[model samples]
Target: MKEESSVSRLQIMSVMGLSKQRNYLLTQYLQAIQLPRGFGGDLVFEFQVSQGRVRHLVLDEQASSLKEQTVMELIRRSLLAWLPEESRSNR
Candidate 1:
């Protein structure tokens, strides 16, 4: 049906928009962490979307000896701080 197709199109557009926003935010976070005191080694983040939910992995080559929970908590706080006020509120 035309209505169903329109709804599907809208959903696809929304997903794509979210993907773009996520990528931009990730890039900004990466840039912000380039400082020596932030993240010294190669840092990579992988994002996967499934069933409208987004999951992320942060790999820091320099994080050896650091507790996983600690690293994740730091990254989460840093990324949240990097996000816009509106985006932070939405989360």
Candidate 2:
């Protein structure tokens, strides 16, 4: 979803392969997070999958109108992107 290209898809697949190799659960049917395309126009989508199904799917229409919340989510995602999928303690 980051970029609509074959290379991006391949990167995602590669990460999934790495996750499996590291014993991370692969049962999540799908996982996605979609931020609003425009302010106050669309809902923010956050979907989490567990046990081959959706455990939570938050659709916040108001999030688009709340600049603070949107900024927080952006920051959170950025921070998360910087984190290792497996903590050092796991090794």
Candidate 3:
């Protein structure tokens, strides 16, 4: 379990790095949202946006019963709501 967790963390970082490398827009978007808590935990949520689309938000860890798809949909709706018209319409 601990090994899987470590691998997941590394994978997330690699994905984030690739996202930043492949898409400057995504990198910039991610920068807008702040992570109040560092990644990896059960009690905190990390925020990010990519390709002008918000990424899935994980309020709970993988061990929790929360659905990942639902969480992502919620984040998408939320990002749309929070973003200004110019930002949304332009994409």
Candidate 4:
């Protein structure tokens, strides 16, 4: 039972880490005016905010098996964690 719980925890953490990595990549590509039309098999996140703040994160070759909705949820969670503590925008 303990081993099972530990494995479960690790799996959850792995998902979270993947989400964070995707977010970080997106932040790096925010300003890209042109991107590959398709990345073959990868999870891509295009995050956009007001005032021209745009972020594009990608998890190339590492997220092909995940559903689109799942990936989106991960993106949402990562963004929520990233926002400034003082920001009034509620989830």
Among these predictions, the greatest lDDT belongs to 1
lDDT of 4 at 80: 40
lDDT of each: 0.43, 0.37, 0.42, 0.38
Off by over 4 Å in 1: 1-18, 37-40, 44-76, 80-91
| Model 2: pairs clashing at backbone N, Cα or C within 3 Å | none
Residues 1-91, model 2: lDDT tens digits = 4974322110123232234633233212112234344333223545453433333445455654344576446534532343233443444
- Which one wins by TM-score: 2 or 4? 4
Clashing pairs in 1: none
Best by TM-score: 1
Error of 4 at 9 (Å): 14
Model 3 poorest 10 in a row by lDDT: 5-14
Q: Please give each candidate's TM-score.
A: 0.31, 0.23, 0.26, 0.24
* Count of steric clashes across candidates, in order: 0, 0, 0, 2
Q: Candidate 4 at 61: error in angstroms? A: 14
Report the lDDT tens digits of candidate 3 across residue range 1-91.
3544222111122234334433444434434553333234322345465555446655545543434454445444544444433446777
Question: Alpha carbon lDDT of residue 81, candidate 2?
Answer: 42
Choose 1 or 4, whichever is better by lDDT: 1
Candidate 2, residue 78: how far the Cα is off, in Å:
27
